[model samples]
Target: MRNLLVFCVLFSFIFFNSCGEPSKKKEENQLEEISENDNQEKSESGVILFFGNSLTAGMGLDPNEAFPAVIQQKIDSLGLPYEVVNAGLSGETTAAGKNRISWVLSQDVSVFVLELGANDGLRGVPLEETRKNLQEIINTVREKNPDTKIILAGMQIPPNMGQEYTSEFRNIFPELAEKNDVHLISFLLEDVAGNPELNQGDGIHPTAEGQKILAKNVWEVLGPVISE
Candidate 1:
């Protein structure tokens, strides 16, 4: 009787341990599977983030009407495998953009379109400061994702700021693009700027019609980059 009791106890202990081991392993495998699924989703849904000020935000227009949204439509139409995230903030300056860039780059960005410095120029922030801020932004993006394709949008301030400052500001984008070996959009506003019909009442933000032109301007450079 004593031997039979000891044998029964040992059998129970072995049975429980054997069951527990597989359960623990199964739970571990499930957790690993979930982690892999999350990574796959992130990889498949890589984003093309448009980070900038009011122009990128599409101020005074419906959220869908923004140039970034317009670009999203275009991307969808073409059946591209990327999502567009409009990270534009109205009235944002270069200094503000520099401060926020690190947080903005936390996501996985396949393509980064930077449209800033217009507010800095309008506010008459130091030209050198603007250039530095822009360079830092590019650097931060590169650090986050070396493979991310960058497109720098050029901006121009009104002559009221002075020719020297405007010229320097205008040169900042191309110089940064060439220095960093990134794509450059010669002028963000292009045909929209100085056109009363294309601008909002403030003569700064683009009208809906103007947003289309802005979309076209971005698409010209962006389309080829994404295609490659």
Candidate 2:
């Protein structure tokens, strides 16, 4: 049935990314733990958590190639006082993200970029459910830290799911951003999507060159927020 098919798709998507997991710790995580002696060194970095799915995790590519890592490199170049944590799960839906968000927010976050719901849209998950789950995630972030700046990455899917469904899915990101009063990325994929050269053989995840574009897209909105 449809439920089984959805599960299969999710599993396959996750499996594809699982192949690249050994390098995640080395490339995606940038938390700094200064020793007491080093505490005098100064510069306590706040965390910038990038929470989402495969795209955020940089599936099919090196973790360093992911946009979040790219953002971290940018932050380092400018000497920003923030660490970037890539919490992207390949098969994550908004509902799945909600279940794990509390633990993820255990550390204080200066900026949170949310990039989920693409899997939901692809699997034809109910639009209302997707919207509600995303709202909950946003709410959880605010509750965890009232001062944490949020950036919601917008996602869009093809019309294979019908015009109404596709349109509703596309609108979820901006509507939630407006309703929650947070920064919005407009379209996370932007120029990267639907471009054959920019994507992998799967024609979904972006290539290394494409990730550079993704980094640019995120920096456009993120640069100002972190700089502010």
Candidate 3:
């Protein structure tokens, strides 16, 4: 009878231990999955905010086909992990971009590509106002994110707008870039600005091929800052 009780007790011990092993393993697996997810979130590279208007919206082209997208592809191909946020709103002026600058800067961005002033120039907005708004945007970004890199993409007004006004608008970007000690991506439309073949029918937006070149133009300046 004592031997029989001993045998029963041993059987119960073995059964409970066997049952507890799988449960412990399941908890460990759950903990591992949570840990992996947290690690991935922490490993993600910083954000790139492209703030501008239709030229930025890639009007007449797919959003994913925009120059920003091209830059993203280049970054990926080079195996640099980063996120590109297209904050382009069609027909948005520098004033409008300024209005939203605070909200946009709320994101944890590593870089900013300021591509406004085009719509302001197109609409004949006062060059001083454009300069002021852009300067404020730059100053705000710098103040909020001291380490964020900025690339000022320049824009030119059409000749019909009179050379004085045109030159003032064009010079805003470089001047601000210099004042802030940031990089300047001269002429967002470098290869595609005046070329009919490169521009879409609107003569403002770029063709698909043109967008690719524009992306490269911005990348030339941006790549270096981000690469480092």
Global lDDT of each candidate: 0.89, 0.88, 0.85
All candidates: TM-score: 0.82, 0.83, 0.86
Candidate 1 vs 2: which has more lDDT: 1
Superior by TM-score: candidate 2 or candidate 3: 3
Task: Write candidate 2's Cα lDDT for 1-228 as tens digits.
Answer: 445545654565577568864443422222122233246433477788999999999999999999999988999999888889999999899999999999999988989999999999999999999999999999999999999999999999999999999998899989999999999999999998999999999999999889999999999999999878
Candidate RMSDs in order: 10.4, 17.2, 9.4
Residues 117-153, model 3: lDDT tens digits? 8888888899899999999999999999899988899
Evaluate model 2: give its lDDT.
0.88
Error of 2 at 192 (Å): 0.7
State how far residue 150 of model 3 sits from its true place (Å): 0.7
For model 1, what is the C-alpha lDDT against the true structure? 0.89
TM-score of 3: 0.86
Off by over 4 Å in 1: 1-42
